[model samples]
Target: MLLSDFIREGRKALLALYPAPEAGNLMTRLFSARLGLPPHTPLVHPETEIPPASLDLLQDDLDRLLHGEPLQYVLGAATFCGRDFKVSPAVLIPRPETELLVERALAAIDGAGPGCRVLDLCTGSGCIAWTLMLERPGLCVTAVDLSGEALAEARSQFPDRPAPHFVRADVLTQPRIDGGPFHLIVSNPPYVLERQKAQMRRNVLDYEPEMALFVPDGNPLLFYRAIAGMALTQLLPGGTGIVEINDALGPDTADIFIQAGFSDVSLLPDLSGRDRFIQFQRPF
Candidate 1:
């Protein structure tokens, strides 16, 4: 089949599930990934042909998209902080907004010097953990997650680099820090309320790991409280921390850190003008 024909049909099929622009976007991305072409390369090469051997495989991928599978999971990879990271249903696909968390964390580490200790809580897919280590090669990072399946995926992020210390620990419980205090703590833990599930699309609610995405509706700040408690004890003097929060609960989330003794708590907004993160510092 011609690649253009496949794309046209695939986009039409996806229209049943997504709006026109988004449906076109997903097909373009899938074509780019499969054909090793620039996304815009397709418009210029409208007559490109799919090698006969590859048609069935590409069709199977389109069928998956039509059925509500996430594109990242379909591709088995997610681009985060300008690098591709491994992703599976076992972990949440890294979102662009979370890249803000990565940027803030790296900025917090800029002058902290070599061998600074950094910790990542609920290190799904090791996206943040691996981005920090790769972007600034001198930091010693320890990433903890309660899910063994998640840890296994995080460990495989960058095979050639010195990977972060992947540890298994329930972030909700009191965790003993063995490598002394950390200079920075960052997490993008579960903060979605169960009630909000009704607002989400099946591509996320049905396919992504629920354990990594939600908390009880009655107490949506559960993970924040536990993580802040960990940060309070684990951060070194003058240390800093950042965590991604549900945009709607910025102040409530910030209060969790403030009440836990982080005096410099400040909420930061994402590109969309929603309060998306809270940064706090342990006093010197």
Candidate 2:
């Protein structure tokens, strides 16, 4: 079959499960990748023919998508902060809004000298930590997560550099990892309330790991509270803390940071103007 024909068929199959434009885009990307073609390469040129094995792989991926699997998981990778990172059901898929946390962290340390220490809490897939290290190679980084499977996926993304010290401690019960006295601490921890689970889309609610996305309904700010409390102890005086939080819980998160003694507390919005990030400085 022609590549264009296969894409049209794939889109129809995906639409039966996903009712958004993303369904079609996902199908196109997977189909292109299976064909050994770059996602942006033209599909139908008079000179090229589709490979049989590529068609088989595309068909298999379409079946997975039909069952509500996230396209990123199906593709085994995700793009965050302009870099590709491996992903799996064990880790939460990185979102664009989380980039705000990284941006604020970078801006907070804009003039800092070399050898500054950075910490990324609940660092699933190592997106934030790796991005920061890539942006500022001089900074030393430590990334922590409670899930061994998630940390393993994160480790695979950065094979060349010394592997980040991966700790398997719950952020709420044990927040301190070995490398600290950090100049910057950042997190995009589980802030989604249990009640909010019913409202999430099928692809996310069903495919993404819940441990990385949710907190008990009765205590929605548990992770934030825990991380902030630890930062008060581990962060260097005047160090920065940046977190990506739910828009609905922004005020509460800021209050937690304030209560934990972080000064200059401020909430910032994502590109869509949703209240999403909080940045503050530890008092000297």
Candidate 3:
């Protein structure tokens, strides 16, 4: 079977679940991942024949997509901060927006002395933690997650490089981390309200881990409150704390840090200009 024909048929099949452009993109991604070809190959080499041995595998991947499984989970990888990180149902697939959280955290710690301590709470897939350690190389990072499975996934990334110390502890309940007095504290913890679940698509709602994605609607700022309290004690004087937040709750979330006595509390926007993150600093 030709690559182009596969893409055409796959896209048509996926259209039942996705819009035209997205369906086409999913087909392209499946083709690229399975065949080890560039995404553009299907278009450029329309007549290229797919190996008979590989045809069944490609179809199986497409079937997963049709069943509303996220392509990242099917492939066992998700690209974050320009590197592909391992992902599974055990951890949330890293999102592009969270890259901004890492950028701001790095900027906040720039010019710091070597071995600057950093803490990452609810560190799913360890994307932010690993990226910081890899990009700066001098910082000491400790990351925490509640799920043993999630912690294992985080620890498994970038085997050749040193990983942040991963601890299994419920972020909302843990009072203090052992490695603290950190220069920076960061998290992309659960902020999605349970009520908002209906607004989400099946790919996310059905496939992503609920523990990493939701909170009680009655108290949606639960994780923020806990992180704020942790920062007050764990952060070094004049240290910074940053986190990704649900867009609709920006001001509300910022207030959590402010009321916790963090100075320099600021609500930051993502590239789309939505209130997507909150940053705060411990007073000197």
RMSD, candidate 2, Å: 1.7
Candidate 1 C-alpha lDDT tens digits along 1-284: 77888888999999999999999999999989987878876589777888888778788899999899999999999899889998999999999999999999989988877799999999989999999999888899999988999999999988899999999988888556566599999999998989899999989988999999999989899888887777778899899999999998998899888888887899999998999999999887
Q: Per-residue alpha-carbon lDDT of model 2 for 1-284, expressed as tens digits?
A: 77666667778877777776876788667866566676655444634556876767777788898898988899998889998889999999899888878888899889888888998999999999889888888888899898999999988897886556666778889857778899999999988888887888988988899888888888898888888888988999999999899899888889999988889999999998988989989999
On lDDT, the leading prediction is: 3
Ranking by lDDT: 3, 1, 2
lDDT of 3 by residue, 157-252 (tens): 999998899999988898799887999999999999999988999899999999999999999999999999889899999999999999999999
Total clashing residue pairs per candidate?
Answer: 0, 0, 0
The parts of candidate 1 lying over 4 Å away from their true place are: none
Q: Rank the candidates by TM-score, best first.
A: 3, 1, 2
List the global CA lDDT of all models: 0.89, 0.85, 0.93
Better of 2 and 3 by TM-score: 3
Among all windows of 10 consecutive residues in model 3, the one with the lowest summed lDDT is 39-48
Candidate 1, clashing residue pairs? Answer: none
